[model samples]
Target: MATSKFLFGLLLLLILVEMNIIEQPWMPGVEAIDCSGKCNYRCSKSGRPKMCIRACNTCCKRCQCVPSGTSGNKDECTCYANMKTHNGRPKCP
Candidate 1:
């Protein structure tokens, strides 16, 4: 009886370990995409570098990436590029 209990405990432990080794379940757009060092746009020329940085950071946080420059690299992330204003203008700065 003691041997049987020990074997059962070992089997349970192995099952738990196996579960941990499995891949995380599918989660869409749940993880933060890092966009470090990618906000180097011409925001300074816009006379509102601070505002540009804030807008860039906001978009980067959502898309996990940034475009190449200030004007038109929206191809990097469709979600970021497609983000629009109430009047249908691009919202990212």
Candidate 2:
């Protein structure tokens, strides 16, 4: 009986930890930004991909772009490109 109770408690703890990890926001993955058309032009002309990445990192916490293949993970996070226009042009490559 005691062993069963300990196991149950351990399981509960593990579950709580898992929940926390799932709930926490995740940072953007490498190769996350897609420099297609306008995005590439803006980044190249302005030289500000790092700034865009930073902005996206901050905004992604609240907004959801796309879900990840991994369970309970987000594949795409919200970024500036999605939010604002890029110099009246389309995305770049």
Candidate 3:
């Protein structure tokens, strides 16, 4: 019975991972996300891709994560969401 329960738990954990309900832990240096690629995608719709990419790079370096879409997904990465410019506006696109 105990063995069966353990197996069930392990199976459930695997399913969660596969479904992306659970994600791998973040550890800098151990794993690095493709910031350039992610930022490019995130900034693709911007009028100023160069400026957007530059700001995104800075935010990604600090937060180690980028929001999942081209826009309005800042809630996905709080650090990115919270970043501000000198005038106290959202910095990351």
Model 2 backbone overlap count: 12
Write the number of the candidate with greater TM-score, choosing between 1 and 2: 1
Backbone clash pairs in model 1 (N, Cα, C under 3 Å; residues 3+ apart or in different chains), count: 1
What is the lDDT for 46 in model 1? 64
lDDT of each: 0.69, 0.42, 0.89
- TM-score per prediction, in order, is 0.53, 0.26, 0.66
Ranking of models by TM-score: 3, 1, 2
Task: Please tell me which model should have the higher TM-score, number 1 or number 3.
Answer: 3
Best by lDDT: 3
TM-score of 1: 0.53
Point out the worst 10-residue segment of candidate 3 by lDDT.
Answer: 23-32
lDDT by residue (1-93, candidate 3, tens digit) is 999999999999989866767665554244558999999999999999999999999999888899998999778999999999999999888
Per-residue lDDT of model 1, residues 63-92, tens digit only: 666776766768877878887778998877
**Residue 76 of model 2, lDDT score:** 45
The global Cα lDDT (0 to 1) of model 2 is 0.42
Best by TM-score: 3
